[model samples]
Target: MHTSSARDAARIRVCHIVHSGKVGGVEVAAALLQAEQHPSINYQVAVLAQLPDGEPQAIKAPDCVGHGLNNPLSVLPVLKWLHRNAPDIVVASLWRSVLVGMVAKLINPKRKFVIFLHNTQYKNVLDRAAHRLGFRLADGIFCDAPATRQAMTAELPLETGQIHVVPLVARGGRSRHTPEAEQGPVGAVAGGEIRCVFWGRLAKQKRLDRAVHLLAELNNRATVPVRLDLLGPDEGELDEMLRLARSLGVEQQLHWHGAADWGRIRDVASGASFFIQLSDFEGLGMAAVEAMQLGLVPVVTPVGQIAEFTSDGVNALHFDSAAPVAERMLSVVGEPPMWERMSAAAVAEWSGQEDLSTAFETVCRQFLANQQANAANHVIRGAVS
Candidate 1:
């Protein structure tokens, strides 16, 4: 089964390549999955950019190498490194990594190149062109959301069967046996305030501003206080988002956690009962998934993978991205009892998903196994010929 201790039996090595080891959903997912990957699979990472300051060093791939992301010739060095080592399978994540994988595959044809797109792809004419190029280069295609898979497969002259749709990897699988009603610290919610949390980069796609507006909405109708804690690296828009939050008078209620790693964010989120995500779209939000793992109910608009994980009146409160953001927030957590039930449901639904590490490990082994079978078939056919 290629368990964590089955390394002695492993016949293949897998390398995961990402654009950076910075504090974001994709980077964090890569790190968490890497940690959980089975020992039997020689798991490694190739980071394409320098590790940002304050991000956990452990998140970087083991024996990982990085090429300065801004440098045009970055691919050449990475391509050379991968060529030298020649991992059995190279799973490249995000856009840059996909390009890196495509180039590296040209030099090492036998090496399986899997392009893992973990975000809502913005496809223009240029993007579609690159998609075609990626399709031509990839041995396997993985998209974090069904929409992403559709985008990759639709209008592209490629084998759609190769595309595999899955959520952003789920991390920290815990015993879901804890009754939802009694999941968090005792008396944590007695005050009637829903301690809400949000974690992600301060980018337009994340719609941090929309998230703040949602908080203002929740606060307006709250029986008590509803505080929002946003934890992530500030990618220059934190000030603008903060101004928006201030404009709404939620500056006091909004806690801007400029930049933080997973450990600190998770630790801080322990006190939070709800996770807020009102992004325009997401690939598969690792932040939202991590919060769900901790039993926090997600109140996210149905966009990208959010639709796949969240169900209205069920596990999560789904809102229209185009609707009044605050009005939607009010519906999700206005009633304390409703919030409690939703929280439990969120944990339950999250637990139903495959463990992040296990899912990644399975994917790696599947690629290697398929490669082996194809090789054996080629040999058999050669002898017959």
Candidate 2:
């Protein structure tokens, strides 16, 4: 049996309340942070919905309150849990969790609350209104990237002091490309098949149709056969994307691996060449970073923090009407020197990031320290008065 020492018992308790316990970048990031062994932080993940079963879990969630987001009683269970457990701090991960955390703080104003911003775009007007109101009640905010923080402050009444930019580090993956291979002469590998991979939700914002078009264009230009792999759960665009690929006569070249964990992704994508994500917007484009960690050059639209980190024709190929995405990709495909250089650059960029668990702990402790300082000042002023 395991037991806590006095020092361990004295550590700050942190509960990250998330909307769902399913496998995705946000949920996986939260789960990994919770699993990290910290000397001064005891982390717990509480999902609004029941923990999912029999599906490939990215990381096992710790707690489930048995409530759904749309249910009117959703906040009550979370509030009740907060009261029963009395964690020292609550970090709400998504917009829905923000509402629950805001309500809990209103009822128990002594507890500290923080918001972890995940995206740069709002789902709707309702989401925008809720964030504007809910964020005002948060003690602090941690954004996935600077772009997320900038977008929030630009539209909402948020101060720069209240927000912190802490990029999430990629969970490790297998490296497929080597520096020697990258430095080779310009051309396709002898008898090699060109493979491209995309790992994210099949949603409209991802614009997967554009990926299919790119595939057709690549095959049209290349002497070798080209294939595209799609990974992640279908978020209502599967049928349309399949039909479009069929119409373009590239259905055979499209591979679908639904809702995969990181291990599975590495196993399947290890030999892949390019990681493609032309999302309309992203907080940090985490999957792209993950791909980079594996030495896969990115062919992404320069939006959100993707623009901040990637350099066009240097580490990545950026397309935004300056030229078609296919044209940019073809430029890399025909030039082994350029492709190898980009691959090496992508790997080096991600390897330079801080360790994942340490980054999370640092951000959480900063928020806790600030809250304690503020509380101490308030008490001192009261005693003086």
TM-score of 1: 0.83
Candidate 1 weakest ten by summed lDDT: 181-190
For 1-385, candidate 1 gives per-residue lDDT tens digits of: 5565465445456778887777776776677666665545566677877775555543655445565765667787677667666687788876667777888888778778888877666635655565567778888877776777765566655442456664564443442222355333211242556677887787777777777777777777666787888887777778898898889888999887766765577676777766778777777676676676666777787877678777887776665652464555455555667767776776676555665555666666665566677678779999999
Tens digits of lDDT, candidate 2, 281-384:
88988888887777778889888899988988888888664237777776676777778888888877776566556677787777777777777877999999
Let me know the TM-score candidate 2 reaches against the reference structure.
0.88
* Candidate that would win on TM-score: 2
**TM-scores, in order shown?**
0.83, 0.88
Residue 270 C-alpha lDDT in model 1:
77
Could you tell me the C-alpha RMSD of candidate 2 in Å? 4.5
